[model samples]
Target: MSGELRIIPVTGLAEIEEGDDLAELVAAKLELENGDVLVLAQKIVSKSEGRVIALAGIEPSEEAREIAGDDEDPRRIEVILREAARVVRVRPPLVIAETTHGFICASAGVDASNAPEPEMLVLLPHDPDASARRIRDRIRELTGREVAVLVTDSFGRPWRQGTIDVALGASGLEVMRDLRGTRDPVGYELHSTMIAVADEIASAAELVMGKLDGVPAAVVRGLEVAGDGRALDLVIPEERDLFR
Candidate 1:
């Protein structure tokens, strides 16, 4: 596949809410083929599963209050704290945390942007991998086509200046492609050349699914990748983690 990959954005999806059938919505909009990879924004998944919270409904803990300081909203901080396993870094603008799912992201993958209400906050889907699997299986049952699903969220990198989409959970797709021991063009052996395929697909799909465009899902085609792996495979083990 040397030409170009095709990314088709699934547009006109109504505002997702709790109990919405996301698999049906996506299957109705796009004609999925075998090996097609669907990348869905995490916000829609969170909304569909009622993972949103009203800041007014929460009470701040002492740790949350201390972590937030004076300007920040203590209730929001409390929610972040509840979602996080440990605080990675604390700054006025943001709080980076290691989520219970082993994901390191700002505010424990919580989001206020595009929230249904002004006082509401959207949190990452509880058990995102399970969510992905369910969605994938539903789509297959509906369309009778084998497909992959990836739950994605925009995340700020440590050294990078801007945000990019990354895979939070995946099903029926290979998250990483390890190319170690493979020979290069000149027959030279390669080592430690693992590629984050799910993240790449997520970021590429984002090019078509704008942040505020109301497009929640995208289909990535024309790539030749096959495996039975989970998004957890993308995480760096604690023992090998260089960055704390």
Candidate 2:
């Protein structure tokens, strides 16, 4: 960890669309450097990957209709269900589900905000880790700089109010910092201490890329925590999950 860190927001990107070259677009706007951590919002990645869905095209099933009730649109619920592997909890309009990517999030990461059009929804990337890798690889090709890329999304924590940005996908970085055998300053040997470094970096990046700012990307500089790790490294195994 570096004593000085910098989070530079990458702005001026036009509204992303399906089939757009996201890596190229970002590279044109920012001058990236080697060892820089490029943090990207999930919405832009989803948009570029053509993951947006039109509500009018969705046909709600009986289960989706039942879950949506009369207050919410069944079409939206159907989209959420389609992306979710299993429903974790159902409370009226709020559906906590496990996404097919093994992420436990609200509505399986189906979001209506920042959509390209009205009555449309944006879905999480089918393979977020792959998405990150593609962007990272392209950036390297374009700028000849080896920068780490992280796809980030806002997630609500259990028993916590408000949401924080978390790493949905990662490339070229060690997502976790394990200190199991390291000794603390007090000379106490640590047995089980692991830090979610990727998530922390995502949250730090989000401090500059606000929700309404239209800034979808940021570069984290001066962090000496680059290596090989995926966002999956942060996921708790179902067998080890105490809440499940």
Candidate 3:
């Protein structure tokens, strides 16, 4: 049988004050097997990690007013700074960033949407890989089965305006599948042929997870991948960055 994509809505899971047995919660809801993968949105994890703040209480700094720069939304600027401290690089309206994850992104991935509590904001997890490991371990303890867990966050491409999901942290899955030295259809040797299988997997899960829906967790099965907690290895840096 082929692999499956099961997008399960996590209802009443909003006030996630602490990390739960995510893998087990997802597995039990989906009746997963040993090889299943759990794809979770970073928002819930951030909330659980106390990464959320009541934005209403946060005052916009003078720097934030300057950053806003005729945008006329001081709150947006403050939110951006709180999400990202110290701008790494900027180009007029757009500010490319060195996010807290060390991942470069626009707006530092500080999203304002889907905040369950009014006047509240969400931030990304401090260490997504560690969070992923914890969830994986908890799942293993609960079900006595080892499974892969992927911490996913929505990110915009450098030149692209739209957002797609990316794998921020992962375990029990290989981030890249190098096909170098492999033969092609014409018997030509392949070179520089590492597939970013991890990001692709994350994007696929996001297709079902959706941006506007309450369904934040997706159960992905049928894909066989080796996880080594090397999600960052897949991140293409600048000079190496196609957008730069």
Candidate 4:
């Protein structure tokens, strides 16, 4: 048998709702195993609990006018972008920022897709790691099975042409599998084999979820977890980041 782990998108996950048992809802649709990880879109999680912000009433502030392009500054768009962004990218028209929870993403990871109205956009949950932890705990509580959970959001890469999904928050899973001192199939000691497993899973899951497919959840099975508990420590911080 092949040893490679595979993640598959769980289709038809129906829209998530606030106060909904997220774990139970996910577990019901698919048969899960011990090492399987659940990849959840931050958008859906934000939506289900009525986190979608109606921008119609929001007014743009001085920061918004300065941040949002002069031509692109609609009052509502500015408000949502402002609240979501921790840092702003000034060179490009987009807001490349550290999120409230410290995820470095465009517009502080604020998204306009799947928004309720034409004039509205949605912001990510204030605390995604906490959000992931809650979901993981709830799933364990309801199904009595332990599994990893990751909240995902899309981000644009520097020096790259397109955007991709990335893990914003995760729990009950180790985000990275460090193989720094390990060896490859050959006897060569690996110095940089530490893999970002959670981000990889998020990207794979999005391949099936699609930007417009409305699919929000995906299952990754057969992979060995690095261990259990939250993986917020695995990510890099802005100050230490050399790429900025």
Off by more than 4 A, model 2: none
Could you say which candidate leads in lDDT? 2
Predictions in order: lDDT: 0.90, 0.94, 0.73, 0.74
TM-scores vs. true structure, each candidate: 0.97, 0.98, 0.85, 0.87
Model 1 CA RMSD to the hidden true structure, in angstroms: 1.1
Q: Count backbone overlaps in model 2.
A: 0
Q: Give the alpha carbon lDDT tens digit for every residue of 1-244 in model 3.
A: 2555554444333435655555655666656567777788888777767777676667889977776678545665677676675577765446656676678777676766776576667777888888888888888888887778888888777556798888988888888888999999999999889888778888888887787766778767777785585676766775687544
Off by over 4 Å in 3: 1-15, 19-21, 70-72, 85-94, 237-239, 242-244
Off by over 4 Å in 1: 1-3
Cα lDDT tens digits, model 2, 65-126, are 99999999999999999999999999988999999989999999999999999999999999
Residue pairs in collision within model 2: none
> In model 1, what lDDT does residue 70 have?
89
- Report the Cα lDDT for residue 13, model 1: 96
Best candidate, TM-score: 2
Per-residue lDDT tens digits of candidate 4, residues 1-244? 1587677777767666566767777888887676678899888778766677666677777766765666665564465456654555654356677655666776666667777567656778777778888888887787777788899887788888888888888888878878899887888999988788778888888888888876888887787673554446655775986874
* Model with the higher TM-score, candidate 2 or 4: 2
